[model samples]
Target: MTINTTHNCTEPQSNWIFVGVYSMVFMVGLILNLTALVVFFCYTKLWSHTTVYMINLAIADLLLVLTLPLRIYYHLGMHGLSQVLCEGVGLVLLVNMYGSIFLLTCMCFDRCVAVCFPMSCRVREGRKKAPLVCLGVWGLTIGASLPIYISKRSKASKEIQVDRCFGSFPVYATQTTAVASTLTVGFGIPLVVMLVCSWALIHAITRSAVAQTDLINSGKIQRMIATSLVIFLACFLPYHGTLALLYVHREAVPCSLLSVYHYSLMVACLNAILDPLAYYFTTETFRRKVDMDAMTRMFPLNSQNSEGNNSRAPVNT
Candidate 1:
């Protein structure tokens, strides 16, 4: 295989900065996703529709995190790596990125259904959809990413000789189509669906009788919606936003612009960390420990003569 040199790349040292970013994402994401999976499996009460999607999401995050070391190597210079490993890295990135997106979207949808269609939520048949959706997501994302094989092979900058895998592909008609279709399916569709579900969740919560009296429950619903939206907006939007910009540049994008895209991409990986934290907030067993009653029961000395009424948060499971 011939080595392709890109004179367009000048900032080789900048890769070190990105290495730090990827390293941080890997460490935090690994810890958070592992802890979430452990808690989900250990606690029987956590077996629910939402938990099903969450388990898949944690799996996706863990896999995504595991791949970061390869990305770190990509940034740190692989010294002419194998084309297969380079392509495999890109494939794993695509599958897990969109897999997590779909899983998180599923989670938001589950919450919406629980709030708006509680009867369906209680149904045994309805509960089975979660795992089925998880399976479909894994299949679909992997299938969607098969196109990566058609993309060009890895190339390194002549200045750095740092092999860049899945760095910036030259914009061509096929690549353009790929970017358009991926953005629409991977990010655009899920984003719209999540926003709609989140709105519906908020709307349903406000209209319900529980809204008038069950302040804690209502608050939980709000928190879930807020956190989900924040994760999508903060963690995903910037990367895809930069992707769209790259798409617009057409044919050839500036090396400097490619560097910016890489940075935004790393920032987007923080979702692996953020999503697990959301799990702690939204999961019933995890969230309930914060209630005054749970606190009083666990630490009696701290709650002596507490002023307000002891309104134990309702158990969801």
Candidate 2:
């Protein structure tokens, strides 16, 4: 199913563009995710379901950001770079982008259950299940990306130039199917899940005295939802949309559209930076930054974690 097109088109250069973009993502994403990790480990005393998800999300973002240095190396016209390294870099980025989305969706779902169905068996049991879910998400995203790894291989072949590591790779029919499936499950379904979970959380917050009369908790919840949706749409939407177009009409691609596709990738990487905004909203990190009696409380802390960190806030329930 590998199809090679012989038509010559001047591929728009993206070396400088990715250089600027990856540098910014590396610096900002590193600082934010690291701060988040410290707060999760040091400041937070309880390991609630939401904390489990957010901590793992931070790790995913951290690992993803870590890959940018190598990306910068490859983009700097290093001809002697190992093709295996390039492929590994590509695989890491792929897993991070989709894995973060899956984890973010889990966060939303956890909140929804905590707020909307606090007394249900699901919420009570979620603490045990959250870690397993995170493991499953990483496993699934990596497994799903195998076909893409095979297709997007940048090894120097007769058709591929040694200078090209990021793009100008072969696209096979299986790769097309992989991309389509990723769009459906990776972005589309997660988008739907977040919206539904967000709606449920917001509705619960408004109806109940979520913080037992702290109106600001409502605002925090709303802001968390807003950040997640905004990041997902503004960052991921265009990247996936352009990918859809590229695959749909991969043959005879106009230079303009292909350029758009390349740049969309830069925009998509912004999630690594902006995602900390969601962390600030959803976790005790923001409230703990200021003087707050209870942290991350959609509800009060439960009996289990209520012992440690007199300030440790219970997840909303």
Give the Å error, residue 34, model 1: 1.0
Taking the tens digit of each residue's C-alpha lDDT, what string does model 2 give over 1-317?
Answer: 22335234455333877888899999999988987776667656676777788789889999999989877776665556665666677678868988889988888777777778768885677656998999999899888877566655543254644444555442431266777787899889999998888788777877786456855667766776776787788988898888887677676666566667767877877888887766644454445532342333323654345445456443332
> Lowest summed lDDT over 10 consecutive residues: which window, candidate 1?
152-161
TM-score for all models, in order of appearance: 0.79, 0.80
Q: Tell me the alpha-carbon RMSD of every candidate.
A: 6.6, 6.7
In candidate 1, what are the lDDT values of residues 1-317, reduced to their tens digit?
Answer: 11123324555533787788889989998987876665566433446677678779889989988988877887786556664576577678767988999988887777777767877635546767888889999999886666444443322222233434546343221366668877898889999999999899899988888688945577776886787798788988988888887776644566666677777778888888888777654556555444444445558887865436444332243
- Backbone clash total for model 2 is 3
Q: Number of the top candidate by lDDT? A: 2
| Model 1 CA deviation exceeding 4 Å by range | 1-7, 77-80, 120-124, 148-163, 166-174, 214-217, 287-317
Clashes of each: 0, 3
